[model samples]
Target: MILFQLSHAAEPIQVDDGYTVSKRFEKYRKLDTTISLPKLSFTEGQLVEFDLRYAQVGQRELHLDLFHAVPNKPSKGLIIFIHGGGWRAGNKSHFYPLANLLAQQGYNVALPEYRLSIAALYPAAVDDIEQATQWLLNHSSELGISTSPLIIGGGSSGGHLATLIGFKNNKQAHLLTDKPIPLYNAVINLDGLLDVTSELALKFENRKGNDSALAKWLGGRYETIPDLWHQVSPVNYINEDAPELLIISSGQARFTAGKDKTKRLFNENGRTITIIEHENIIHTFWLFEPYLTNLAADIAEFLMDVSKIEQE
Candidate 1:
């Protein structure tokens, strides 16, 4: 409850770890209990199983939770979801609602936790994500999957990482490549910041602590780490070979600058870009159940359409 209050503050603040993974609600766990991914009112029989584990077994190892709606049956597809907490905070469990909704659509969903700013910084999170993706691809068969059209998406900072994975497969790329973290079929950006440089470059920005979040998350000032910033920006690597993208963002003042960066990516690769503008919604509205119904429906339709094309 305290963390929730901190999250809704008008401006961002450095929050204490009042609720970490081990301290969060036990009901969020999959052991000794069952989770029913209840069907959306418009959809039916879409409940999934909760499976959790560390992608690697050690400290700072990635924690991955796979949502499987079907038992003993192979999944038609998979969606890897990353959650955003300004890069410093956030967790995978908070994403169960979104993951469960996706699982109901007959697609297995993987929600993985990367190292955060509170413990580590920039590429550390990226590196962890790479490992998580590789684990998914390497175990695809065991997970009942058989395709290359893996879709990646996330909210805010997580969206930034998801887009980074989609745009470039570089030195750190091996993290997702026990055997090549197959090229994504589509990429979803949920109100994410595509370019940190642009956000910092904004004129008279009211979000006073914008760069603080980056420095805290990336571990250095932009001027001192230009290359690192560029290497991490998904918008900087946009090209013809990028995956199909569906970007959802709010029209609120807080996210306008980041939206501009997303706009540039859309313009560069106009063919595969799908932008959904949410009126009056703030950043990360998808976290709550109120907007999840529509958000899930849209995501389901997009994934289904993409899957159909892959089959063809």
Candidate 2:
């Protein structure tokens, strides 16, 4: 077992937000420092390949946890799933259960670990996601994955990065230069905030307290680094060529600015925009029981229809 010691930054900056970097790390550490192990065994001929490094950030290596369909069956496409922790904390390991379900349905899913805000700032995680996808594409043949189409999805803050990565090439590269990104067949968002330009995000709230995730991830408030905020939001990059979207939310757009633009653009372009909302449930409710099974099915059906991927 590779022990990843995730600790708080020594005297870490708290910015205007009340929560200090050290505190965020502390909260995550209490949750667990490693990936959650698979509690349930697979019986549907599913296969899981663990711990393949897809990229590296300085000395800290980034890896992916993979799930595949029936052995030897070529998958319709590969999915790169990101986990959410308000951009501060989360692990790819917590996703094995869901990955198993998708694998059993015949889709190859890759859960990639990206640099968290505690480790790096805004675009570092973004760049890492791009790198992970490129690495998977590079090794697709050997891994029995097809490159014609790819799916990217995540919940909460993870959903933000997933959607941000799909914007036009060079739109978000940390190096300010982007390599070619694959044409995504679909984009999935589970209550991700797509716009950071809102006055509510940029101004209204105090520079402290629980709403510190975004400011922390961006290195400062939106007013201080407006460009960074603009770059990280996916809503600004919408176009007629954008892929179909599967938006699962309990009303995330109403809170995040520019999200309406995303919905509007998809509708204007005649793209297949499927939104499934569960009323009276909390945000990120799909993560809990009584909602997981139905959510999983919704994802499967959406990917299959859009990508022509099949369930075995």
Candidate 3:
């Protein structure tokens, strides 16, 4: 491991040597575990909290948790980071640690909570994400950040949702508001759910259990509702105009199911895409290890580079 000095050091990452990979949670291993790689550049930083309502549905008022780092300099861009919960369980609060890390790197972070499967179904989560993005776009000024090139990011199922809302064709799914479609400058997907067709869904089922998450989130098994699976998949929505996308993954579960397919789709569509793989880790490793320090730095660098490229 490369040693970084105090001036260049990041907050110590959360490490777990005893993170046993059980048969039940083994599929979770397939997502991006953020294994150690080339040392990343670091920056010291602080977070400023902004708790504000970004949207409303029915009687439920939706609020976004925006965390901005005390900029040592000017801001790079705005990133809306979503939390992963299998679409059944997870809160926007889950990303608080990561939000601060990104903020330190000079990107304002927006962590938004979308409707979960327990409360709403399929496109509902997608609709909520659309509203969240729209809210960010509409309130960029009030939030005190740059509006151009809003970046969308997420982990696990949240990664899936980020991709769905960022790149998928607007006419295919429901939208939260009738305003113009939210266009993203870039997208960062960390082991997101990419495919829900019967083949991949059944594979996940056979690996984990018969109670596959894809079925629960979509309201039916892929075998029963093939069209819905196809419609909600981010891979199905790629085009030349799709945002420059960065997909992070591990060699396990989600990556095993979606990597090749994802690479092929993005390549065929002529989209600017970057794919990085980490070894021997479960999904979302930065959430846990000596990994988070550099992961944050790495992501900060990515955000900076992608934003500059898109701007040029």
Candidate 4:
């Protein structure tokens, strides 16, 4: 197995964002003994490419990790998986295991790192992801993948970003380029909020005053920036043009606010929306074993189904 590391001096100390693998494991282990942190190991046929710079925001260079097979053969399409840290924490490495597993299953996986709330605000991460999707699309041929069924997906905050990118398909004012935003064929949201302006979402996000992660990411509380709150909510963008959706929930209703409305909108447009619910599981269940494996398998199945439908 070959490994490429991101070229950087001594890694900086990670901030206490209250979102980390070790912390999530510690908190969830008591609830379910079957859960285990996924061990990172590359299969013989896997190709892992690390730290490919996709875009630059001033002095900060954004990078992505690509995972696929040795002699790559496109299966469904390329999947760009974003990491969730409430828009403030989490890194691309958080999705490494899932990307690896998905790559081994005959799909090209790109895990991109965007500017966090600490470095930038609201639309920064969204623009970064939009650029990342365009980067993958521009290099799809050389990378040995088809962009016909390109999929956007992520967990928690990442999931919200993915859904927003898929639904909002418009250039943001913060984007550095005038290029059209890349459109996705489907979305795989893993326990991400559909509506940030929901009563439940506001209850939790505004509970800590302006110190909440959501408030920091959005630049203010719902009361202060009601327009921004609604602007970022994926639920508000649902329409006939929206792509197919697969929502995998961890039985947390707060994270799934507006999910019913989203489903109804999709149904009204005759669009496909598949929902897989895992009761009694933690919010970050996609990062661990058992749940991780199941999540990957479900994603694979969804991709295959979407591909078949597209072909027909």
The TM-score leader among the candidates is 4
In TM-score terms, candidate 3 sits at: 0.79
Clashing residue pairs found in predicted model 1:
48-69, 130-175
Off by over 4 Å in 4: 1-17, 70-74, 170-178, 307-312
Shift of residue 173 alpha carbon in model 3, Å = 12
Better of 3 and 4 by lDDT: 4
Candidate 2, which ten residues in sequence have the lowest lDDT sum? 9-18
Q: Model 4's lDDT to the true fold?
A: 0.82
Model 1 residue 104 distance off true place after TM-score fit, in angstroms: 0.8
Q: Which lDDT value does model 4 have at 31?
A: 88
- What's the lDDT of the predicted structure labeled candidate 2? 0.68
Q: For candidate 3, write residues 1-312 as lDDT tens digits.
A: 122232322433121222222321354434534333223234555546555777767656567887774668677778888877677776676676677777766678888877777667788888887787777777778767775657888987888888878777332334435557766778888888676553654676546443567777788776677798788778777776677778777556644355577678778977678777787466655465465665677677676677333431
lDDT (Cα, tens digit) per residue for candidate 4, span 1-312: 122333452333234356789988998998889899898777666778899889977656789999874355546568899999889888899999998888788778899999888768889998899888889888878877666677889999999999988878722322435655566778999999998888888888877979988889989998988999899998887776677899999998988777988899889977889999878588899889988888888998888777333411
How far out, in Å, is residue 57 in model 4? Answer: 1.3
Tell me how far the alpha carbon of residue 201 in candidate 3 is from the true structure, in angstroms, after superposition: 4.1
Q: Give candidate 1's whole-model lDDT.
A: 0.66
- Candidate 2 lDDT, 117-185, residue by residue in tens: 776887888888888888998898898766555788887788878887765542333334345556676
Best by lDDT: 4
- True-structure RMSD, every candidate: 8.6, 6.8, 9.5, 4.6
Question: Stretches of candidate 3 above 4 Å error?
Answer: 1-47, 169-178, 206-210, 307-312
Kindly provide the TM-score of model 2 when superposed on the true structure, using C-alpha atoms.
0.79
Against the reference, the lDDT scores of all candidates come to 0.66, 0.68, 0.68, 0.82
TM-score of each: 0.75, 0.79, 0.79, 0.90
